[model samples]
Target: MTQPLLSERTLLEIAEHEGLVLKAYKDSVGVLTWGFGVTDVSGHKVGRYDTANGGSRSSIERAVEVFEWLLRTKYLPQVIAAFRGRALTEAQLTAALSFHWNTGAIGQADWVQSFLLGRRERAWSEFMNWSKPKEIISRRKAERALFFDGRWSGDGVVMIYDRVNPKEPRNPVWSTGREIDIKDEVRAALRKAGSAR
Candidate 1:
């Protein structure tokens, strides 16, 4: 059977998980990023706030467009290739994409390799290792839930740390607990953004 492409729901879930950023900013590692964690497109790299040569600000529409394009052309293929013979649910694929968007190394990630090798429990434990800055922990939890349970909740998008409270946790229960309804939130956010086509 041919593998399925990411469904609209999966794409929206990823966008919701990533959140929308209209302006380019330096991420945790100081890489210029924007539009759902995109680093570069075509040939031009995104701009950094501290640099005199920052990338131009983007509109919501443009940002969404670029995000979708990059996922289709870059990240998705890497994921598809990684799981070439395995069948994955939409949620699982979305989880992998989200992880890839965050770390850009999912193709080589030990968790992914473990999953591919059929060590599912090992893969799940590996997810937690990505945890940091609360947001990443939350995101990793959510992604792990999606990978294992196909469920998520507590803010559609994962919250990143700002300078004020880099260590402060938000919605701590989400990291340890399970809830539902995030699919609804993802759908709602996509509808509101007018990107749910």
Candidate 2:
């Protein structure tokens, strides 16, 4: 049987799956804080330039910015290519788009390039596996679960991938300069990102 792809809603859910503490509300450490990054992908700290009220914006808002950034800059192209001109169901396209938005086909943009080229399951696995923390294996495992949850059509909670931490500048860097699609794949990925949300 053909493996299932992610839908847009699931993609959002995947993004929201991993919860981290943002710095904005970090001062009251012993108390509750609403600021949180998406766990990994550079912005782990709370008050850095790229996350949790560190930069010109707030943390939760930054999370959304990061997700949109990755999608526009690093992941969108290959995504379009993944089903390039093919009839991918809206669900499949939206879901995969979300996966790319969060996990992103970064440093190794080729995997996504190849996924689009080959349209294989292993590529999808690689896509999911890419969501890893630099130092924590446990964190990586958790991200994997989030990414895979969308593999099949399910209601996954979607979070923001904030990019306010200087450690992670590319989180919101979209040099490609193309418009994002939420009603479809691009727009959906772009939603909740920066002012666009």
By lDDT, who's the top model here? 1
**Where's the lowest-lDDT run of ten residues in candidate 1?**
164-173
Per-model TM-score versus the true fold = 0.70, 0.38
RMSD of 1: 7.3
lDDT at position 77, candidate 1: 78
Q: Model 1 Cα displacement at 158 (Å)?
A: 9.2
State candidate 2's TM-score: 0.38
Off by over 4 Å in 2: 1-11, 24-59, 69-74, 98-103, 106-197
lDDT of 1 by residue, 1-197 (tens): 55455456666667666655545555566555665667764223565321234334555556655666666667877788887757788778888888887777876788888888889899889888777667678778888998889884434443332221112221112233232233454444445545454
Name the runs in model 1 displaced over 4 angstroms. 1-3, 41-44, 48-55, 154-197
RMSD of each: 7.3, 11.4
lDDT of 2: 0.41
